[model samples]
Target chain A: MIIPAKSRLWSTVAVFAVAVGLTACQTTGGDAYRAPINAAKTQTADDPDKDSGAPTDVSGDSVARDDGDSGITGSIDDYRIEDLSPGERPDISSDEASVWMIADRAERRAANAGNAIKDPALNAYVSDMVCKIAGDYCDDIRVYIVRVPDFNATMSPNGMMSVYSGLLLRARNEAQLATVLSHEIGHYLRRHSYQRMKDTIDKTNGLAFFQVFTAALGVPVVGSIATIATVGSLASFGRDSEREADGYGVLLMARAGFSPHEAPKIWENLDAELGDTPRSRSFFYASHPAISERQTMLRALADEVPIAGGGPGRIGTEEYREALSPHWESLLADEVSKRDYERTERLFDALIADGFRAGAVYYQKGEMYRQRGDEGDEDLALAAYHAATQFIDAPPEVFRARGQIFQRRGLNVEARESYAEYIRRNPEATDRKMIEFVIGGLGS
Target chain B: MKKLVRIAALASVLALAAACQGYTLVKGGSPVEVGNAMKVSPERSWSKLTSGKYEIWTVDGPILQQILFASGVEDGEKLFPTDAQTPKTLPEFKKGMTELEITELYRDTLVQLGGTQFEIQEIAPKTIAGKQGFRFEFTFATKEGLQKNGIAEAVLAEDKLYFVAYTGAKLHYYPKNLPDAEQVMGSVEIL
Candidate 1:
């Protein structure tokens, strides 16, 4: 059942009370957030495969020892490809059972809320690709293509994968997309969420103990804020888990016959688009390893992996473009609406460099320049719009943009003609009445 | 004195509850001043809320439906608060902006307010407060996945902006309160 917000708050308070009660008897000081290593790591360590040479302790200590503060070291060469056979599910502990229940409830709520994109063809395409990487364990996974414009894909412990449209827009080819999907699948395979949840509970309990003590000392507000901060810190993956997932993902993509080189390229392109922004401080970035670190490790792993027939393997650029072509306008529109003109401009430049859809790229570039409206931006916007119209597949909004610019410049005759052309091209446009009104004013 | 104390206790409780819910009742048939430059006449009771420059009125709740007003917003001011460190990148209103530019400003405001997916359904010139202005219809979804439909009208005069907007959930709330919102919009006048 969906818990009401107030009830959920009270339940959390109850948990806090229990924790406080437990802490009242103890006097030892310890860091609360550090929980046990992931169950997969623990299990693998206990039952080390004699053939694989995988590390026994896949923990942060190992990463710290290898990489130090440079965030570069700890190669995935030690990780081995697990034999995931058909009809095999991980044995769940009681803790994992509880997490599974929570994940199930969340997945049900998300589906019921109409957030899951219901396009059968698109769903099949993405799921088929995921299954290719998943191998015999494919049936255990369910993919949801959500219409969010953030570069993220999440894997829930209950085998629910949400692929956001922003990832699709950023991914230049199928191999890059596969790389992300495989990484998320790696999280599921490693059972990171279950491990993370247990760690969060331990942290919360500790924070609650501290909170109660602080409240007793007459600083309830500060204590409450501390509790929130402790919880918020749990959202990002731990460094070791991220490293493990990255290594596993590279192996999985190579096994699926996708070019493993695309993995590093994705991060390289992302770093270029990000351009030294202090995103590493953000919670979203904090959860994962540094981009440069991941890129370096992925490149190393890709170089080590042997090609099936010594070929470049499948990039599937044309296939990926074709699958997403029908949704390009709406996706590009979402990207532009973000109003991050610099980032959007960089993205458009990359797309143009790829030479896939020049007309769409120019149209979006026009939008970015038009919306920014800096000194000399209007002329730049006009040139981009004109360039867009030179292609056969230029969006109908080009005429509207041209008309608005012309009208602003007091070129009434040109504005009228442009508006008329826009109206003629898009007869069923939602703003038909509005454009008509502009045309009438130009006549006067 | 005892009775008065009891009454005061009840009043405090009610106030706390109202604050927790994020709205206060604006009695029906009341004339509410919106911003510094405009007044609106409401035919029915509504919830009134304030966040930065936007004065919001709602029937069900702010999450379901809202009517927002902003008057005399100065140039160089943002429609919403932005991260102080990244001020240059955030969209801000400028003086002598054309109608299209103003519309873009509003679009950016909605985006900054966490509208993940946004589309302008319609835009055109309209009369607001007896002056030439612009009106637009739009649809968007919040980051939290709330689908909303909205309409807005704005006029630039006296080197300041006067604006009103209504937004509601696309499924039920928008259609239910759109007519009432339109009527409230019609009743706006520059004072």
Candidate 2:
């Protein structure tokens, strides 16, 4: 059950009280936000938008220490991507095990959802391009083309690379995709995941980090134990990992012959896409350098590489748009469900403006209206839904919405027919049960 | 000159080998096996399974590779929560289900976990425990080196219906583990 916002905060306080009560004997760290030690806090806790009075500086310079600092020396060689096959690389026994587990779990969940694209051509294109640019540095890495509409990429500790579909959509060319992928590759090579995990353990557990890893249960088990058994609070690693990845990613992009400046440009788009969303994704905050910070870094790094004469860099723009064309309506539907009406409406208008006529746009407009309800213009919604149904290939959602409209207007038979058509078309839909129940309520 | 060239090649090989020496990768050993088959059917009055206790199974082969418990089991109910009012959000349980909704449920989970692209193999009808159901094969890649591949069996039986999901790697490792999973499925019985 979802807690009301006020109660949620107080519930969190209660949870905090229980946690403190449970761990009262343990020594509290200086200037530390006492970690909640309860199952409720662990599983259901949301990532807070602002820091809880914790001191953090997200600048790139924080991780780059002087030469005498443990011999790291900020040398170029330290960040080079080591060429190691999957079997050759050392086990990530020291990394944040929870993050890897979550990533793995997410992958499994994706596979289970049947949300994968079966296009071998697209997969091969991405894989080939990524390897050509970054393969020499690492060999055991795996690439996945996820069907998400957001422009993002993530590199997991286990060398699992997930590229969002939106990235494919937004990139000006193959070079742009390579620039982002190369940047992520840099994160893996620089051992950011491992370091972050270690840093988390160090900060939270103090001297107990060594004990946790060396337990008789084994490291993976220890990691899982930490996540499952202990309070799974939001564990953001110290700033070192993000800066390291950013620095290394920029270098990789530059070496691979893409404009390093594109990295920051990507972030600028990302920030705009986010608009006024209160909290940014944890991965972006956790792993990626800030957009402004990254933009500045990339501009400075641009000095090392030649600013080449321009070419028509609209790499795969047409193909990207074409491939996504079939799923445009569905993607819009998904965005609408997430209550991202602005993005949904914008995309709808873009498709219409791009000559995608027929009832798809009209129907989507109607769907957006219904979603808005009291917060939206209902008259426009009714007009759009009616206009949408006039098309030859109207989707089940349109019929369903029309059915709801009919039901509201006291047209029982018409509503039943519409609902029936919707149910028939979307037999595999998640809402089938509810629709069936609704149809049942309409009576024979 | 030939002898000198051979020495240089050997030196380079040794250097490469040394660079790899830092990683003690745990690899092939005796193949792991599922010793006993246990079927978990929701029909035989589930007083034990959903008793708020996580059931963990211990097996051997790979380190830390243990069979975990599938929590919150019930007949004709979803393992995870979805909006009940939204019929389109959940699929139809026709006949009642051609394929278990595990794939469907798992995909939803992925989106929550920041999955941008998720997909699955085609689903078809099948039978388990002498009742009609469906089988779905699926694969996914993520930022971590975890290539999770899975198959789920949604079966029906007298007074009970449920699904069994077996997941492992998409590589050579999956084949090695499938038999163990099968053995476990075979072992499971209403308890």
Candidate 3:
């Protein structure tokens, strides 16, 4: 299948189109040099390749007439970037509906984090400020703030931007957060997700059918998308979508007046955080080129536009830590879930060093120990639980572990006391009845 | 034509089943006698689960089949604990069980491998290995965007509670393995 370039016309035509616009960027010795900032401004001006300049070579012309209340149209600035309408206007309100769906999902996930950690005040604070920074350039897209410790974010098909709490924690300053947020906002303004969804809808019918069939037929589809989307996102918006998202994100970050340089730095930090796993490891950052290449391009761009304003100095590292202190343990729970032992261990050590107070950390540490019941590490396992109990506000799990160990050693009274304490502390814990029974059995 | 093809497929499976009748042990060796009963142990030798990397005790039985045993003379973590909740929950493999602890025990035995999203669905009582048991199902959202369910049943038998947990991609899992799981459950006997 012929892959359409951003101009949406076949590459043969795009090559010619680029040859014609060759005056925009000066090529010296076969290497492209950063054009003056005005060149970008000039190239994006009233060029015929204006809004939605993707190729008109769209073969299947099934038009889903958008609910036509002239949906968020490109403002004068939007006209500067190529108009990114994938095909005919989809229902305008349909976009809103989707944004609400994703935002609702984010809210539900936030609810899952214990109330102590999930703070709407914090979510509102970040959302309000971050949107103000990026929205100055893109549309006022709705942002969903989730309470997770992983530094990740995704812009769905609609204008729903999900900002993981981990991203806030990891970012050193407001400019860094702005760089990341702008990249995601760029996804929406550039219409990457919708274009991808549309392009892949027909092609991925088989995989989608398989997934739907498996769900209907009662098969586990968990962690098996390798058989579905990974093979070829063609039916869904393939690698092209990711590359497009990255390019647009960088462009948006630059436009938003944040240091575009931080975009690549954010990626490099992510790579380091993840131990530089190769790009092909999982489809998470599917479109991200090598970290070096991204940094190279970002640096080139930064050299072109020396922002009049210097870096937005690192924002509240201490305040970010304090705001997130409550959920430090639960976020560690995510690390355990992802099986990033190296990262989980590091987070565990950091939390201990930082003197954060939370019952979840102790519980998670206890869990880590329990998971590590390797030979000769029984002592380590025991120690993890002991540390879990040292927390000022220990969860019932701490008592349960102590109780289980005591019972195993035939210390029935100690076990009974521990179990009873657990029962008293976590009256509503899922395993309450079970622990009570164990306590009763000890008495028997 | 399609109907004929399907019937032929079914007939072929039936024939294959008839061809492989009766119990078979690894290397076709004699069944190991434990207590008063003979049992098929996949732990006959080194496993391929983690051929040279790590070891996990993974036992693949017929659909619905349950394998029972301990790690060594020293008790290892419970394979399927009596109590396990979902989402914010964990596999009751036992206290102090490491990633290697569970993954290594059952090496390369699980087919149709998928992730477990431990969400507490429901907890109830059921019969497993002819003893009092707790049956808990862990619910996980699958990559295919479906919720996969795993039912783990643990029962105290032969001075030990055998834990059998079965998780499969829905369409071809529980239905196909339920009968085999039942047979394994029935065949279980203590020393």
Candidate 4:
């Protein structure tokens, strides 16, 4: 927990300086920071510390109130689609423009420095999906698919949207994917980032200013960590923004002819995946509305606006599965590597329920069981691997896994046969010499 | 807040002073004993660092390319230092671990070190220190976005794990030093 002090000091100083500069130069007309139209609809205020397993009585209540404009009010039903065309840029103050410029530069630098997935077809597919929901605002937003294995996405004030692969992997269908994308787009359209920044600066007195400076430096991790540290109190402010975004996102999906039910289903799946794990309180979940709360509110909203045709509308599950087919193994591998056994097991169960990529799902389940190595885990692993082999697209590693288990049990003949099959299937296997050596020993 | 600032400033000064100390130079074509359990011969000279439990060696620089030797790590002992009170937990080396389980231990270690995007490219049985062992190839990206490639070999002898890992930046350093690492691994001998 002891971070490098030098880096922390630099980050704190940098953020503080930027916040002060932005505050002094503020000249924006109109309420750029508006309270959520649906604040009353949200049952409880967001308390990240409470959700994160920390005591709720932590100090800094004053900092929590600085989340920009809290007086501007309306209901979720009061929102009307604005003129979001590329030609009709939203009004911005000079100070807001400066923040946007910095964000634009940082995003461009990040695009070059970070591992961006360069799959044109995948990018185009995602962009098209976002456009369907974005309407006229589609041209104002550019999508960047990053290669990180964490379930999150963000939209900066500069109109750059990053979709992490983890989110894509977790999403079961196009509707689910659209739900997340539209939520981020809601943040963009509402100008939440700008408002949040202003609030942070105003509340901290001087401590929060360093956050803005670090963000401007474009040292990715430092800036991000600093923002998280200083912006802890801003979670209440963020909760309001998130609630607003959720409302907006549902409207977007329903209008775009996608099933709104998928929105809540995303959270339901996530809730199940998290179960009672400590990760339920992790930053990813903490910064957003509680999953159960989101699921309930979204369900209510979806019920209010039933699909026009009475049909389920476009779930796009088949198309989504096909599009992500090439990346499935790698995505699944990333999930398995996290070693969160319960979460991974639930994920595999969900995938199996969908009946897509059953072979790979079975294989991954086997891997989880094998890695857990509990008393009865070996039997479970063997059963899962055996099931995997029945499917056409089962990974070749299934044979090797079987061979190892048999070898452990001193079933030499079975192990040798399994190893031989593995060698036959994977002629260019990197561990061919080792497998061959095992076979040689079995012969003796 | 002021107290935090002072403590941080003091820590920074100490860190700077520590960095000023140079590494111990290891001559090429010389045999080296790693920890108390294993020895290896290096064909080329390297710089050695004794920071924690492992003996670290670097050719170009630790950031670009390095080798780690962990010898005689006992049961319930952490491979790296960690604060007991921290929420993050490090995996410990345990006796009676299968090859797959041992690899998982290494994977967990890498994750603790901020290698979130770690992938095992290959794992197979191999001979190390003239005894049955396992070797694994992996790739990972650091939090700072540096992609790394690594190869590791380990054996459990006398109920303790003896391990060596070579890692380098995937862009250029990995391919450049892979042969030298292979040669070093080949020369390993358990006392």
Candidate 5:
């Protein structure tokens, strides 16, 4: 259930605030933007606006292009963050320390999270990919792969990151995943949430602070979806920061030797998935940068960043499929349960086009139509089910579906034949008795 | 100190705002009809809330403990209510659906309700209200990672669905209220 944006506005005052001492430094746009964590008091549980930074960019003069500390005179690409984490955090503010403690708490919670995908092989596979992308900072960031069926990722200020299972289902290739991870890493490198928190505390105090802080941070506009999970962009940072992070993530992907061109399509595909729904999907919409703007900016950045081998970057489609397909059924079930018809329709169509799991995808498409029971959806469901039965992996449920439709239409003979086939293919089916009873009623 | 106080005060305001929801009382030893389809006699008192097609009862609250009775769902109607604002549509109950499909519907409904994990421990035939129905036991977790456990009974009579489920936090609440839930479930009668 989506809480109204207005009511949830105050929830983002400060989920986790980090204070980093900035030093004048010079760097490349490809470099990450992490400042050391110091003492700060932030992160409130149920902070409505704290969790997600919507995908949309805030376009206006309110977004400060040059938000860097003093003497940081350079294009965003050339901006440098001296050290994201230093050995000693001596200058701890009570606020920052409290933030750290809570961040630690959030991390501990992630460690035992029930939705965690428990497959050692899948975990190892993803961890290895994250390791390759993380480089020297890999040790600081802890990754959690959760089974939430939404396209979201989150990086806590304490170096905790969560990758939702739906992200794996949505991303067609390794490169796409890399693009998002690199972006989240870019957020850590950039320290967007901390920066936003710092900006908030710098300006206000008292009840007015509580009232206006979330609004000023642009948290209210996109805070409604923070529970879905988030990373740098999901936390509702200023558009300037989000824009920079988006560019940085693509550049990082390009530098890491994954195909950066796949970056923009993440938003494009998500936009299609959202498909005129009133719900604001925070990761890529209704927040900071617009999808078209992000796509254009990301595409330009992708073109700007040069790859190492000078050949097109690696998409790693085969590697991604091999690593994730074992858990594909569970992931797809969660996806279907979401019941976002347009989103699943788009996703299934794309999967079919990619030849990822044509039979399963078709069958699921039929299931969606059949389950929804909207006008004329049954005919569409039957057609897809028929198409599904042609492939090797088509489930036995397809026959059951056909039988139900036929029985409802008074085609008892056809229904009986279909039920017989369903029972014939799977002798130990869980619903065998029920099917048999129905077939008994539809005698020859 | 000043900043800490400010943040704490803001939290208090939020808590006050959240406490607006009120619950009705279900008296002990009294037979109660829920959702216009079933009646049950509880051994203890509890708080209750009507959810249009169902009724939810709780001791500490829904997060800690809950008993759900969703009965009389007709063919082509949803087993659960839809949030008008969310674009998502819940799957409908159909005629001739089997116990296994019903189990799937429950699982999907939980998933849609933000349950992160569910593992069914058992599904077996059981007698309910003088008729053979299905009973299921399972463990689950919410999005926040809190573990939970539940026991449920379901019967399909005249193509109308009758279901009762009791769920609680796995730590202490489940064990604490399992007996209470069982008693209520045992007293269930189709009205």
Candidate 6:
């Protein structure tokens, strides 16, 4: 495929991102620059050029080294989360203090950001989840649920963590959400971002490696990836850092009474969403190399840590469903607005499979097709809308949409039924009079 | 390493070329046709980008303040350019979109275009282009962390869309230029 120069430049950066000699800053694609922002764990262990259809290589053997190791390390059991408290403060006039200052400023801005999900109920639920997984340091972290429509989360050194709306939409249950949260918190506890700042920068090659990303941020061409990487810790977080976070995430899940088994499923869903993007392959970024290996790795870690109560861990699918159900429509609306057909479809399919608010998820799925209006998408949209009406949570807009489609198909009777249903369901609709006029125009 | 350096150098040169897109001066009181349909008379000189169906005019840099005029948006076209080849996730303008959906498309388009912390403070019915339309007010922060406020007027007539929006840094630029933007848009004439 003849990729556009702008895209080609970014692919060049993502694929051939000038290597940070110490770590090879494996740049993945858009989603890699996003969630769990490691794309977090898997990089193809083999030559990147040889990597394609990278997800299926899930065998435990495809593991890439953390730093300079020859192979995957056995017994991640030795990893220790750093001790931290809510009362801790960075020393004044120190490098760590400067990072904290920048983060604090970013936090203040993020706190007031318009894109933040301001619903008190939703914010409280996410904060409680962070506390559950974070243990003693829970008080140290402040969570911001950004309304960005991508699967990513990041915690700045100053304890400010942003969980994107896309991640919430993608994660099927609470455990999956906890997985990402714990992973970010792990990065925080480990001081990974600080290490990256002091260790990665100042290194000549690393500086050179980051220059393109820095330039991309100001300019538009390749900046989308750089944009995510810059704010989301994409530029700084490395491979081993991801593995460690994954380990901590699993442990935290087990500790918080969530099934650690759900942890790796995040990657499985990500691979499904990303499909054949370069970020998924070894060609570039080599960010997400083997899916099953990481899954296996996560499973192994989960197996090692027993849930506290042995009650199969609190999967909490219902509670998670209930908490997010109220906000799914808005969250999915943001997700759908990205207009990535295949990925959005995958997300919908996952939501459907989860069976939580099927009406809401299917309604957005229909809207996706309706907005794209591609060939045969009309029929697909109609089918989706029809399916959505079967559930209680479908928005009133679906009937109006179906009414329009039916009217277009010259099925006035069906149109009237759909339109009437819309009016019945939404009596207070601002456009009620308009719908009534449209119905009158349709005739009896 | 050498091969990568060569590519990076090529990327820099291309980036420079891309960045140097010159702007033309739209002198005060000059009636300029925008988006091949609407004609507006600016009350004062402004800098306008000299390309594409989407027209943007600025007094200070665009990061601080700008006026955007989008006209003749037909079915299946997006309101703003979808920068980069990521996805068609940017909302598209379909024919027969209701005012509510249109406002949503504009808001979503802005967010997808990288404005964050967005909120529509108010949206109410009004008149634009001698037809029944709508106007709305919103506040958002740019990726660069500058807070901004915006006002827009739009109407969909005969399966085409005409929109005028002015956005500026919320503190001073937005309030200072509010009158000029209003007068400029107030002079809009659809051809």
TM-score of each: 0.74, 0.48, 0.48, 0.78, 0.74, 0.72
For model 4, the superposed segments whose C-alpha errors exceed 4 Å read A1-76, A83-93, A112-116, A147-150, A219-237, A277-293, A303-312, B1-13, B51-53, B75-89, B96-108, B116-128, B132-140, B175-183
A1-444, model 5: which lDDT tens digit per residue? Answer: 234322221111000000001110111000111110100213223222334432221221122423555332223365444547533231477444433444565566568766787789988887777777766677877788888777777776667788888889988899999888887777777666556544544543342234233322222223211211223444455556667667667767777789889988877887776676554444334345677878887887777778757889999999999998787777776777766677788888888888876777788888888777789998999999899899987778789888888887778999898888998888777667667766876755
Question: Can you write out model 5's per-residue Cα lDDT over B1-191, one digit (the tens) per residue?
Answer: 23433433443443333322335799998898888789889989988766566777878766667787888888877655544322143457777776767877777667655565777776767789888787888888866567888888999888899988888778898899999999999998998
TM-score, chain B only, every model?
0.82, 0.48, 0.42, 0.86, 0.88, 0.86
Candidate 6, residues B1-191, lDDT tens digits: the string is 34434443444453434333345688997798887788998889997753346777777656557787778788988776444432345678887776656777787777755666666776666667688777778887765456788998888788999888898788887888899999998888888
Which regions of candidate 2 are displaced past 4 Å? A1-44, A48-88, A91-122, A145-152, A164-176, A201-262, A281-289, A296-314, A323-400, A411-444, B1-191
lDDT of 1 by residue, A7-100 (tens): 3222222222111211100100111111121221322212211111112222212112122343425455566546344554546666556456
User: Could you tell me which 10 consecutive residues in candidate 3 chain A have the lowest summed lDDT?
Assistant: A21-30
Docking class of 3: incorrect
Model 3 Cα lDDT, one tens digit per residue, B112-166 = 1222234545445555445555655555433223334455555554334344454
Model 2 lDDT per residue over B83-117, tens place: 31112232222222212234445455444433324
lDDT of 2 at A89: 48
Better of 2 and 3 by DockQ: 3
lDDT, candidate 2, residue B86? 19
On residues A173-262, what C-alpha lDDT tens digit does candidate 3 reach at each position?
555676667656656566655554334344445544444333222222222221121111111223344444455555555555565666
Interface RMSD of 4: 14.9
- DockQ each candidate and list the results: 0.15, 0.02, 0.05, 0.19, 0.25, 0.15
In candidate 5 chain B, where is summed lDDT lowest over 10 consecutive residues? B13-22
Lowest lDDT block of 10, candidate 4 chain A: A24-33
Give the lDDT of residue B37 in candidate 3. Answer: 28
Each model's iRMS: 17.5, 21.7, 26.2, 14.9, 15.0, 12.0
Model 2 Cα lDDT, one tens digit per residue, A1-444: 332223222222212211111111111110011121111122212433221111122211222212123333333444555543434445457245544544455445344333455467776777776676564644656677765555566665556677766566545455567667876676666545555445444445643343333221221122222322121111222344444555566666666555665656656655655555455444345534456776675556545444333432223445555555566665555655454566556556655554444477778778677646544455667778778777776676777777776665567798789878887888886555555655666754
